[model samples]
Target: MGPTRKRDLAAAVVAAAVLGYLLVRATYRYFPPITVWTGMSLLGVAIGLAGWGFYVRARIRDAEIGVGRGRLHPLAVARSVLIAKASAWMGAVVLGWWLAVSAYVLPRRGTLRVAAADSPGAMIAGLCALALVVAALWLQHCCRSPDDAPPDADPAPG
Candidate 1:
């Protein structure tokens, strides 16, 4: 599979940020409190994907070197690539989302919504989103051809 396109991720982030900003602006009438659970969910998804990517990468490496009875299925690798792509795009959107939210919440702390909003959770989610980007890249690195990888006996994805 081809590498995840930077343009697509950037576009998604921009779109999500604009939408998020507009959403928060429009919802000012209702002024709902931002839930921490959403942020925690984002963190959970990122960590889960990263963990799964590591498992796939290890299996692929073992298969490539003809170690053990682990057989690397082409479909599994394809799925991993898809997951990486999705993670990259999702991370960008979430990062931009929380950024917009933070921008809105920062100067308006006196309001009930701003005071109650979990800005710290949003920030934590943003950091997790960043982690997902690195994880996606690492997963892509793991999917490279053996020829593309180094010739070392114990090679690692760069």
Candidate 2:
């Protein structure tokens, strides 16, 4: 499969944002208060992904430099790519949802006590989702093989 495209992720975010905004506008009244734990959970996932990225980068770099100690496994790289792609998409969707929730609540904060209470939590969660997306992208980049051509480059003539 090809690399995850930024454009695709952007489109997913936009779609999710619109849907989340509508959902919140209609049903936020029934929902419980958002907690900081949501952000903390996402942050934890992002940190794990970042750590994996570092390990993969080192393995790829060492293999490219002909280090026997860094013998990379093809299956591991494949699994990493899949995980990174899924995480990126998941992060974008969550980021959009949290951002929409924040946007909706922030404006109502002064008039609604519940909105005021939820605003900061939503913002924090949104930031963590953004971090997840960044970490996933980094992992995806690390999985690219040294022989792979730039996404924008044309193939060489035979």
Candidate 3:
């Protein structure tokens, strides 16, 4: 891999690690009394890790084919996008199902004691988690190297 590609990959790893930590902390704060929240957080972590795994796998393939020495190839970009889309879809479906189930289960079990749905802390934490997922998806789609540009493009005049 070239210096630039190596740098980009390293930066991505660092950013993901930091974001993952923040997401975990926010999840803990949002659902302090529920084990379900921990499960959700773990799911998020797994999704993130899966995405990263895809990324590294793509990178390795690119390197093997001499594509990594240049900019990211279209195939690598496509792989990352697919992984991100899968992760986002999975997270959304699982989270939605959990929320729906909790709505009924909690009330039926007489465990809905907290009456602060409108509480600022809870709202903020929820929003932060949502934002984290959105950001992860965006990052997965947006961070491709310049070499991954579409073919049949005209070179700009110098």
Candidate 4:
């Protein structure tokens, strides 16, 4: 499969943020309050993926250097790449969702139970999602072939 595209990721974030903002503006009152667990949950997933991705990247790099039994299994690399891409996309959605929620709540600070109760959680969730994006992108970079990657693509960290 092809690598994730920046434009595609950007589109996902922008579209989701816009839609999230609109959704909250139109229906937050009717919707249930946002929970702190939402952020915590996303954070947990993000951390797990980052750890796994780093492990995969190290193994792949080791194989490339003939430091292991052989090259990594093709399917494993493929699957890892797919997961990395999806993780980034998920990060975009999560960030957008919480960012919109936070924005909506900031203005209505004194007016809504959900907004007041959830604003802090929403902000933290957005930040965690941003971290997820970074980790996902780092994983994608790590999985690249030194000779195959384009000049603009990231190189493996030292």
Candidate 5:
């Protein structure tokens, strides 16, 4: 499979953000307060993905350079690629959701006590979600073998 396209990711984020905004507008009163734990969870996942990406990059580099330290199994690389793809998509959706909540609440903070209270947590969650998306994309890049062409590279005619 090809690398994930930025256009596709952007479309997903926009679609999710619109839906999230509509949902929050309709039902935010029924929702619980945004909590620190939500942002913390996303931050934790981002950290884990970054760590995994570093490890994968090092292993792949070693193999590419023929350093003989160790070789990554083909299946392991495939698994990593799959996980990265899924995480990137999930993170984009989540980022959009949190961003929408932040957008809705921040502007109303002065008029609504609940909005004021929720603003900080929603913004924090949005930041963490952005981090998750970045880390997932990094992991996806790390999963690529050295021989793989860059995304912008033109293929040679057969």
Candidate 6:
């Protein structure tokens, strides 16, 4: 793989690690009841899905390069980046919705009095997840195939 592809793969690995750490830390810190477990589980699943998406995209890009397709157009690059972002956002929303629902239901269970008290760690974890998504997006934007030669400025030799 080229340097750009290597960088993207590295970024994906780092993002996954960060997201995992945040999820585990937040889950224990918050110590939510059974209902909140659903939200935590969703968050974990979202992180995993987003990470896999990043890996798949990176691998595809690498394969395209190996097959000699040359570099992708800027628009294609942008589209790939957008797709990764959308996937991450979808995951985040699923997790966030679960968290919201759990918060609403938890109060009725008479265990917690305020959402704010338990949300700091969860919010930090959410932010970490967002950061991971952004990292994947940035990596997609930066990748380029080595086969993409510079544009010609001179006329062709006879």
Error of 3 at 10 (Å): 33
- Model 1: residue 80 alpha-carbon error in angstroms: 1.4
The global Cα lDDT (0 to 1) of model 6 is: 0.48
The local distance difference test score of each candidate is: 0.73, 0.92, 0.47, 0.80, 0.88, 0.48
Per-residue lDDT of 36-150 in model 1, one digit per residue for the tens? 6656766677677778777777887787798966866878778888888878887898878887777667667667455446576566767777777777867766766666644
Q: Rank the candidates by lDDT, best first.
A: 2, 5, 4, 1, 6, 3
The lDDT, on a scale of 0 to 1, for candidate 4 is 0.80
For model 2, what is the alpha-carbon lDDT of residue 25?
A: 94
lDDT (tens digit, per residue) of candidate 6 on 1-158:
22224344445545544565466446644555333233354345446545654554565576766754444556765555665555555444433533443344335435544444445545544455455445544454444343554334345656
Candidate 1 residue-wise lDDT at 136: 80
From the highest TM-score down, the ranking of the candidates is 2, 5, 4, 1, 3, 6
If scored against the real structure, what TM-score would every candidate get? 0.77, 0.94, 0.38, 0.84, 0.94, 0.32
lDDT of 4 by residue, 1-158 (tens): 67788788888888899999999889887866666666776777778777877777778777778896666677877777888898999999878887888889988879866678888778888888988887787777767765676757569856
Error of 2 at 83 (Å): 0.1
- Clash pairs detected, candidate 6: none
Error of 4 at 45 (Å): 1.7
lDDT of 5 by residue, 35-107 (tens): 7666879899989998999999999998878885788888988888888888889889998899789989989
- Mind sharing the TM-score for model 2? 0.94
Give lDDT for model 5: 0.88
Question: Relative to the unseen true structure, what is the Cα RMSD of model 3?
Answer: 12.7
